[model samples]
Target: MIAGRVRGVLRPLSVVSIAIVLVLLIYGLLGYSVTAVVDGVLAGSVTSPSAAEQTLRWTVPLLLMGLGIAVAFKAGYFNVGAQGQMYVGAMASLVVGLWGDGRAPVLVIPLAFVAAVLAGAVWSLAAGLLRLLLGADEVVTSLMLNFVAVLLLQWSTSGPLKSRAGTGQAATSESIDAGYRISTSTGVSVPIFVICAAAVAVTAILVNWTRTGLEISLVGRNPVMARWQGINSTGVGLVVFGFSGGCAGLAGAVEAFGPAGSLRAGFSPQVGFMAVVVALVGGLGALGVLLAALFFGALRAASLYLPVVTNLPQSGIDLLSGVIALLITATGIPLLRRRRRRRRAPTAGGTSEVADRPVARRREVVAR
Candidate 1:
């Protein structure tokens, strides 16, 4: 019994473990020195004080968005629009921060953060409601919205909010005053860390210790059964999606206020997508998501350092990420399909055997 339980627990863990080993193996075969790569990753991510800060900087947004993905996955929803949601949130924060015009930091900061969260939630709800009401696919809607959000950010930064006296290839909004900023350019700050800790704690409790969490899990496993149990599965679905988007928005606000300090075009472009990978690697558990965020954070930090040290292009890191996402997605598909086939095949075979046995028995009776 103990062995069986242990196997059950370890089964999910094997997926992430395999992915890590595979990534390492591929890196090794590419003529990249394993020690140097490992050491580089370590040296870049945490061996030095600056490296640790960089890791933390990357960790903040990844962790926030990963948590959002985890929640949606737990509810059996694929919210691929975190990137769009984050963009919208950042844009909203920018408008509020710039327009607030030097209000007390205590007041302006909280209000801007709240606006960001609400904007993100509302943006996500559009897709969620469409899925619930019109049967429009969430995946398609969310993915398309990402482009729309990106375009909107470009418009905002270049047209209206463009920083005066700023001249660069990329347009960006005026920087928030120092008092309104959450952290300096280095990204780590007491406020950012405190907010992240709170988010993690709250989400962990919601997933592990709340009735809503139980209902969300039940709906994910079987909506029909959940409905039979008198649960409002549709409502649960919307709430989960909204909450997930809101978290992504909160991460965007943090990026604007804490590290980036303004709305920049293409800011955090792929962090939302990376959060999806982090969610998958973390096995959709809050604690797992935390650890996975750290690992991916290390990778992000290392990616920046690689171009400086090695001859590898920054695009190489993107290629590696794309490969991992493809492999992981492919791996899950087979397992899911096999399980479905196993379930359906047994019923199909049983029915066919029952029909055949009756015919054979009749033939035996007629012959006798």
Candidate 2:
């Protein structure tokens, strides 16, 4: 039993170690000093209070989006349109904030947040509806929607919402009112902290403590089996998709009100994709995503700082993320899937372990 627990702990650690080793080898082969790369990472991530703040700033959005993606994955749905969802959410927030310019910040801010969440949910559910109703592939529909969202952002910023005060070529919307801003440019503030804390609490409770959570795990592991046991697989799918999109939308709101203070075309282009990687690396769990987001946030900070300290390009950090993603795909995800299958399968004693509950509890659920 002790050995089994140790192996379980080491499984994730081994994947991380291998990814790091591979990154070091790649950098070494490219003629960059591995030590300098390591130093640059530390300096960018945790060298000082300012550095830590920067890391936290990136971590906030990543955590939100990662949690959203993790939830969808838990229900066996692949909602890859976080980028589009975030864009629509940002656009919704921008429109609301701009429309309510003369209103009180307290009222306007909450309205903008609601608008953002609703917009994101609708955008995401569009794809889910297509998948469920029309038998469309969600991965394709969701990914294609990303391009549509980018085009929408481009047109809106360049046409309807364009800021006239900007002389630069980059298209951008007018800045949000100062009162509505939750954080400064650094993206770290009390309001931001409160929001993240609330999200973590709510998500943990939803995923770990609710009957819905058990349904999600069961559906993910084996949808047919879940259906056989009278679970509403379609409802579970929609719930997860909506929840995931809402989370992504909230992240966009956080970005706009906390750090960005405005909507810019093509803003934070990689954050959505990076968040997918974060979810996979995190083992699709709340606690794991929190830790993984911090890890990637440090990498994000380091990527920016590496240009200042070494000859390496910023894409080097992306390469590291890509490598880690590959490793997780090959090892972590498959391992988890297999283990889940094992738990659901019957043992030699003719008793099933099930996913979140024992076989007896599963029988009770089926009977109901």
Candidate 3:
């Protein structure tokens, strides 16, 4: 029984254990102490109070953004422009926060989020419409939009939103009034934690308990078949894209109000991209997304403390995350998908229907 319980625990953690070992091996080969690497990850990620707070703070955005990406992927949207949508949302939130100074704190905060959601939905529609009307590649358009969004933020920070008091090398917006800030420089707070819990609960209900979730899954697994079943594929696409983008935007709003308190150039530099990895790592499930976000958040928090604890550079954690990402995508994802295909064969009406889908018929709707 003891050995059985150990096996059970090891089975679930197999991928994580292998990834960690590979990272340690690489560091050892580079002449860095594998012991230091392990020590640094533990101390910098969890042992210290400051590190814990940082991890929690970053978890907010990653969880929010990962949910959005999961929504898109579940619908086969492949909307990869979360970075761009986030920037747009941040821009809108900053505007509301800075310009609506006399408004009640509660009113302003919610309004900022509203503005962010609208901005992100609108930003994402640019690609969605193209995909719908012109059959354009969403991956390309969404990725390209990221560049546009970044430039828009750069212009906003350097021009209209530029704080005249700024005397630093970086471009940033004027600070939001203290009354409108959600959390202080400490970054983590009770209200924020409650909000995160509410978000997770709501997301879980929406994905598992609602009709829309089922429809999205149906559409994702087989869009052509979904259309035959009277589901409006176009409408589904629109809602999925908007929702995915809105979630990313909400994360941006929170970042502005809770942590940064002002728009800055290249803020949370790789978070949008990292969120994609989180979704994939989580196996595209709601609970998986949360756990993945928590893990990545810890890694991000430790990236700061790593340089101080050992000879490894701050980039060491970044490299480790990259390695983990590679291992997951390379080895596990295909296996996961193959298993899913087996389980889902009986789902597309019957094995005959899936097997009988002709080559030309399947080409009617191109997926990115």
Candidate 4:
């Protein structure tokens, strides 16, 4: 049993490790200093206190989104709209923060957080509803919503929420009160850390110890079988959608109250997209996601540190993220084959073993 569990864990970690090496080698081939790249990546993450703090800050959003991605993907929903959900969530929090100006932090902060989470969930529910109710493809709906979210973000910053007396460099919203700030602009704080920890704990419990999680896994593995077993596949999809969006929205709230005190036109640009990579790299497991989030978060901090420490362009780290995604997807072939094999298994009675099992059991038909 122990060996089985260990092997299961190793398979995913190996993929992530291989992907990193491939990315590094590719960058080196392109004329970048592999050593400098490694050093620059580590400089802020482990070698410097301030940079380490930045890594922690980045980890918060990535971890939150990674957890959500794990759950959604496990339920077979390709929620590519996490970016949009995060944006809408941030927008909701910003609106609440602005309107609650002068309100007690104790009250306004909680309210804004709820608004952010709900806004994100509502946004994601659109794709879920489209896919489940109208028989539309979730991939298309979620992907398209990303562009809409970006436009909405632009409109929010430049239109009603624009800060008066803002400089020419970038448009932004008015700052919230200091007391309402959960963390400083540098994005590190005890409360923020506590919030992140709580998120992980909650997700772990949900995925590892609950019937909903088991049902999600069952539905993901085989929807027809799950339905035959009396599992509500549609209900599972909707729940995963809401929960996933809520997690993304929570990440947005963290950004607003923790690192960013106001809504900037564009901030942490790649977090949502990178989070998908983090989930894949982490093997879509809670513990794996925590580790993956820290790795990616450190890389993000390293990206910021690289330009300052070396002559490498700021885009270098972004390349690493992109390459990791490309390679991880390449590793999906074996799993695909396994799934296909499972689909083709046959019982001695010559029935389709995979599909007929649950459907047969449902009708009290025993397999010989």
lDDT of 2: 0.84
Model 2 agreement with the true structure over 1-368: per-residue lDDT tens digits: 68965664466667878989999999999899999989888998899448898899999999998898989877777788999999999899989999998899989999999999888888899988776555566778888988999999999988889898977698988888898899999999999989888888888889989999999888887765886799876788788889888989999899888899988899888888888878877777788788889999988888888888888899998888888878777875664456345333333343343533666787898999
Identify the runs in model 4 with alpha carbons over 4 angstroms from their true place. 1-4, 333-368
- lDDT leader: 2
lDDT per residue, candidate 3, 15-134, as tens digits?
Answer: 667888888888999999998888888888899768888888888888888888887777777788999999999999999998898889888889999999899988888888877656
lDDT of 4: 0.82
lDDT of 3 at 130: 78
lDDT comparing candidate 3 with the true structure? 0.81
Please report, as a residue range, the 10-residue window in candidate 2 with the lowest summed lDDT.
Answer: 342-351
lDDT of each candidate versus the true structure: 0.79, 0.84, 0.81, 0.82
lDDT of 1 by residue, 302-361 (tens): 888877766666675665567667765775435433422222111212232322555799
CA RMSD of all predictions: 7.3, 7.1, 6.2, 5.5
How many pairs of residues collide in each model?
0, 0, 0, 0
TM-score of each: 0.86, 0.88, 0.87, 0.88
Question: Which candidate order results from sorting by lDDT in descending order?
Answer: 2, 4, 3, 1
Q: lDDT tens string, model 4, 250-312?
A: 999888887888888667778888888788777777888999899889988888888988778
